[model samples]
Target: MSIKKCRQEFEKIFKKYPDKTQALLPCLYVAQEKCGCLTEEIVSFLAQRLDLPKVEVYSVITFYSMFSFEKKGKFVIRICMSLPCYLRGSREILEAVVEEALCIKPNQSTEAKKFTIEPVSCLGLCDIAPAMMINKKIYGNLTPQKAREIIRRYKQEKDK
Candidate 1:
């Protein structure tokens, strides 16, 4: 479907919320779901549809790390790097997973076009330290081997 079609669907979601501000998150989510990332064009389109200033939309997008202006890989891998995860050898796990799956450093995508590896601040799963998110699903209590296995499984599922 085209971005215009996505925007029309987003308009329906926006209509459900009593306030335009309340629709921001869902609207952005729909935008990302349709376009894979929030680019300048999408942001401008949102601002126009929501009747908000472009700067307002841009500020909101910039303030949130969850929003991406650039195109992401098919899989967006977020490895937790907060205190608990740090103490739990998250770095090693991150390295192993990235090397094995994407063959690139953190914040890089593989040449094979399969995955992107990134170090995230926290996933609010500190209790499970060394957690990571694949797309939106959280994986906790990760070891280097577990990370590799998870990536393999995800790739297999995506292939299917």
Candidate 2:
């Protein structure tokens, strides 16, 4: 998407918020969706557009694990590493994904650029435990076999 288009989308979202600051998060989300990841150019554009300090925009990106400042694969697989997930065999699930599926460790993207495996602190699915997110979809109560199957489905999707 073009920068002009992004700005237009931001304007639409910005108009809905009573306070300009309240629109920051949603605007950033829209920017990320358009640009894939939050590049420096995108952050600078947002800072200028919102009349906020560039540092403030960068801070929000860094504070939220969901926001990526660097390039990520088409499918970013986020495995939960919080205590609840860990206690429920998330470690094994991670190993299965890394070893049997993508062949890339956490924080690494596959050579084909199809997937990026990341270990996040939480996915807010503690009740289910052992959860992971691929893009915006969450899968919980996972075992190693299920993780592999999910990875397989994504890989197939990439082929399509």
Candidate 3:
């Protein structure tokens, strides 16, 4: 890992927040962008910079679904399972992802590492009930066929 770059990015984000605690999430994002996942080095760096305990850092990261400790596939597909989404046929949406789309189970990545499927409690897109997020983008009001096509298009995208 490039400590210099990491420190530069960390400090850049660190300066944006008056409350250092408010900076924790953005700092973690910078580290994750560089390393693909959080490392022990990142935890130590963040804790030292934020003047917080390592356990505190761990707790914060674990509580947020956006922060991943493990390196995910090229695309992370998060399906919503919240009540609003559930009422809107999210179960069918999940089945579409598993059966018609990637054919991979939740919390597992495809053999080719193209996608990792996850069942998230909520994406806070209640208005777009029955939504799924691929990486940072959201897709909503989906049918099985639409989900399959979406996955096919994503599969065709070259690694960035």
Candidate 4:
């Protein structure tokens, strides 16, 4: 993810769409992919590059869960709160994450910035139910004890 690569990608996005507005999402993705998080600096750069209003960029990023305006923890824990997962004890799993273990709440990172808990719409693992994903690795069929144990293991990991 280099600046040169982002410029190239932006050029392609601009060429593909007749309307500059149409290139916003792709340009945002390209910039975010290169910059890690879409901070104010990156957002400004993207706005100027894409010929968009800064507010428009901000609005779009805020609306999309996929975009991040600030840096997240090394490990992002996404707990599914979908109806299926909720019915199967996802609430207990969330409580286990918040009150029982890590004091951090949803969308907040630990002090060390090691883990961030994000309550997401779904993980598409309804069959397993009560599922959570740490980074890209999925954990499912969880009880509170199981959830605590999994968190402990991640906490002990030397190389995140």
TM-score (all chains, Cα) for each model: 0.86, 0.92, 0.90, 0.75
Ranking by lDDT: 2, 3, 4, 1
Which parts of model 2 are misplaced by more than 4 Å? none
Which ranges of candidate 1 are over 4 A from the true structure? 156-160
- The C-alpha stretches of model 4 lying farther than 4 A from their native spots are 1-36
Best by TM-score: 2
Question: Among all windows of ten consecutive residues in candidate 1, which has the lowest summed lDDT?
Answer: 1-10
Model 1 lDDT tens row, 47-142: 887789999988888776667776677888999888889999999888888777657888776665567787889889998888999888989989
Candidate 2 TM-score, C-alpha based:
0.92
Candidate 2 contains a number of clashing pairs equal to 0
Candidate 4's displacement at residue 135, Å, is: 1.6
Per-residue lDDT over 28-112 for candidate 4, one digit per residue giving the tens place of the 0 to 100 score? 7877666656777666766887778999989999887657876677778888999999999998999898777788898898887
lDDT of 2 by residue, 67-148 (tens): 8866689899999999999999999999999999988989988887789999989889998889999998999999999999
Residue pair clashes in candidate 4 = none
**Winner on TM-score (3 vs 4):** 3
